[model samples]
Target: MNIEIKVAKKSFNYSGPKNWEETEPWLYAKIFGIGKQLAEKPHALFALPQMIFQIPTNVLQFLFDRNAMRMVGVKDEEAQDEVMGQGYALLKIAQSFANSEAPFSWKVPKVKAAFLGYNYYGPGDSLGMLTFEEFWFAEAAYERNDTNALIAVLYRRDPYRKQTFSEELTEKTLKDLQALPELTKEMIVFNYQGCRLGFSKKFKHVFPKKSVEKDDEQQPKKTKKNSGGWLQVAIGMAGDSSVEFDALRKLNVIVALQMVENKLIKVKQLKRKTK
Candidate 1:
């Protein structure tokens, strides 16, 4: 099955503190680097928990058109068989990207081509506050979820600008964020602890109900087979705050996803007992 995907370019006019460009140019560049990396190897973004998750807009358009063809009986018999196959094909592609850590039986070539086809600009077309928060605090975001880590960096940038949120929920969140310690070099690393704790509190709302499991809340139960086995092996002896540690983390995640795509390792699965 062949499907064409096109994404329109959208600009997010970041209006962060003006001093950031002068004081932390690396952080500024890293934000752009992150977007480029995602475009090149989307499995990196897929491995991490997003603030929001949904079917990519371009993929959804394909699904809708496939269904529309079925209703119209365009090509009649061919459409019936091809449309069914295309649906499965779409699912396989989405699954590979969505379950980034899970083992896969096969690598769908077209899905891979689709992922790499477009240049992504800051989590393009997806509705999430992830890029907003990450771009706002690139350096510290490495070890933390963007949402909670936002306060620490934003506070350092401009405390008064934080008050300009017109959204009621955001306005309320800012009031709560004041409880965190003032941003410092030491606090950059330490603040991640709070960011993690905050995600734990909010996971129920952010992730789907079916995705979360009773035994493990960290990742979806379906993809827990490999767990962090390879990741640990990939980044040994690297300190959390070091540049090497961050690079290895991204590399390993991509490697693991590739291993899954190529069917290199056996994924653990629960055995079914015969009734």
Candidate 2:
């Protein structure tokens, strides 16, 4: 939200994030740190405008003090108290704006058809538009925090064509993505994180569940080897054959995940029968 105030006989308008969804991940971390400081020291309220607005410390100090002294009935000694009061009021207003209780989920990006001079499209809201290969590679990139690779996988030049994954295209796209501004990269990552959350919720049954330990006598002990994470999942779906894997990767992500979920349910049923 925008807050307009006059300082040094000049009016200025400053804006802060209106909600958690609007806040950048880096800014959110700074705000989190500020919260801890405020909890320990109420006087930390004076530091908020500087943190939120990212203005010079001296300018903010002048803003508060000048505003405080303008009040009709104020002694010099009372100015400090008035400043603190104003800070507290501002803090409350900011809190009201920033508080968010709803679970965060991905919304369709506002700009869906193009980015950075490239004509491309993202996986539609259902994510059914992505090939399993593209989805898997994007998730792996996200796990590695590789922003360029993730962007390369999730966006494609052809929305209707089922193009095979191309190393040449990806390499060129990575160079293009690297030239993007830092803020643009952050926004892309933020949107992707939300999409991931939505995917997990939609395909919760396909994801591995945390195993609960049982009494030694009540359940047979089982061990599993550490393996490539998403790669391993892909391999299993492909029957561990390279040719089949390539074909499997061409399947739609929604279909691939549904197949995995069905297999998991059948395996569980068979295990119960054996027990």
lDDT, model 2, position 14:
74
> Can you give the TM-score per candidate against the true fold?
0.23, 0.54
Q: Write the per-residue lDDT of candidate 2 for residues 221-262, one digit (tens) a residue.
A: 554433334456657867858899888888888788777767
Per-prediction backbone clash count: 0, 0
Residue 217 CA error for candidate 2 (Å)? 26
Model 2 alpha-carbon drift over 4 Å, by segment: 1-116, 209-234, 240-244
**Root-mean-square deviation (CA) per prediction:** 19.4, 8.6
Full-model lDDT, candidate 1? 0.33
Error of 1 at 222 (Å): 20
Candidate number with greatest lDDT? 2
lDDT of each: 0.33, 0.62
